[model samples]
Target: MIEVKNTGKPDERRDFPRGHLDVLDLTGLNFGVATFDPGWRWSESLRELAGTDSCQTHHNGYVLQGHLRIRMDDGEEADVGPGDVFVVPPGHDAWVVGDEQVMVFDFAGGMAEYAKAKG
Candidate 1:
């Protein structure tokens, strides 16, 4: 897979929710990479429910910059930062830590699938 970098140029990028994945595509499976800036954060609402967990698929990824935290279904938490790789299970939540931006790459298509699958 190829690697790409985010320039962190605010004016050049479009605005998105504070805790949301801005990009999603099958091609990313081969080049799972992302660059988070300053206040970027992952959504917690995407985690799979326990008893009613859906047929969701999750994959781990590595952090290229800053830091992030993942909260599992059982309430276990983990911290990740530059050069750190992490696996996001089917049932969990995640977000950025402090004011630093977080960059992440993933091999799995990711949580946004629920909406597309439902639609």
Candidate 2:
């Protein structure tokens, strides 16, 4: 099967304090567009909703605008900017790095679970 979706017209949308995620569901895959306003931090903005100390979602994504910083549970860290492709494993925290809003296109699955209140 085949499908096409404009992230702007996402199948699901989630809003948080300084960020939002738009998700598209396709056959056997899920795609997402995440936008983080400056000062947005995963730990501060999403931890309570996710019920975790840090993010547990695996992300295979491309940085589309501005910059983002990711720090792993092991303390390893990296900064990604526009035109960069990155893979972030579970167990990490991320934040916007500059005044500009950060936008990322996530191709990995499981984003439907990201930042959702745990049951």
Candidate 3:
């Protein structure tokens, strides 16, 4: 089977303090486009909503625009920008690094659960 979706019209959209995520649900995958405004930080914006100290969702993503800095629980870090393909494991924090808004496309499955209020 084949499936197609335009992220501009997403199946679901989740908004946080300084960012938002648009998601498309396909046959066996959940794809997402996340936009983070400058000053958006996972620890500051999403920790309370997620009920976790650090992001626990794994991400397989491609940076589409602007810059993002990610730091792992163990202190390893990296900056991703346009055209960069990245895989971020669970237990990490991320923030927008510049004045421009950061856009990223995520192919990993866990984004569906990102920033959801804890039950």
Candidate 4:
């Protein structure tokens, strides 16, 4: 089977401080295009809405623009930027790396609930 979807017409959109997520729900995947503006941080922006100490959503993503820094609960951390593909497990905090905005194509399941209100 084959499927085609456009980001221009996302199935759903979630907006948060300094960022927004546009998702396309496919048969076996919930793909998303996440855009984070300068100074965006998961803890400072989305944590309250998520009701978690850190993000609990896993991400398989490809960085399309700018840079992002992810720090895990165990103190492991890394930075993803343009031309980088990354996998981030649950229990992490992320933030935009610089003054530039960040854009990522999330092929994993995280976007399915990213930025949504908890409970």
The regions of model 3 sitting more than 4 angstroms off are: none
CA lDDT of each prediction against the hidden true structure:
0.54, 0.91, 0.92, 0.93
Give the range where candidate 3 is weakest over 10 consecutive residues by summed lDDT.
110-119
Overlapping backbone residue pairs in candidate 4 total 0
Q: What's the candidate order when arranged by decreasing lDDT?
A: 4, 3, 2, 1
Instruction: State the displacement of the C-alpha of residue 96, model 4, in Å, after optimal TM-score superposition.
Output: 0.6
- Model 2 Cα displacement at 84 (Å)? 0.4
Of the pair 2 and 4, which is ahead by TM-score?
A: 2
**Off by more than 4 A, model 2:** none
lDDT of 3 by residue, 9-114 (tens): 9999999999999989998789999999999999999998988899999999999999999999999999999999999999999999979999999999887788
User: Using alpha carbons, what is the TM-score of model 4?
Assistant: 0.96
Higher-ranked by TM-score: 1 or 2: 2
lDDT of 1 by residue, 24-96 (tens): 4333443334555565544423222222333244766878778877777788889989888777777665667
Worst 10 residues of 4 by lDDT: 110-119
Model 3: lDDT to the true structure: 0.92
Candidate 4 Cα outliers beyond 4 Å, as residue runs: none
RMSD per candidate (Å) reads: 6.1, 0.8, 0.8, 0.9
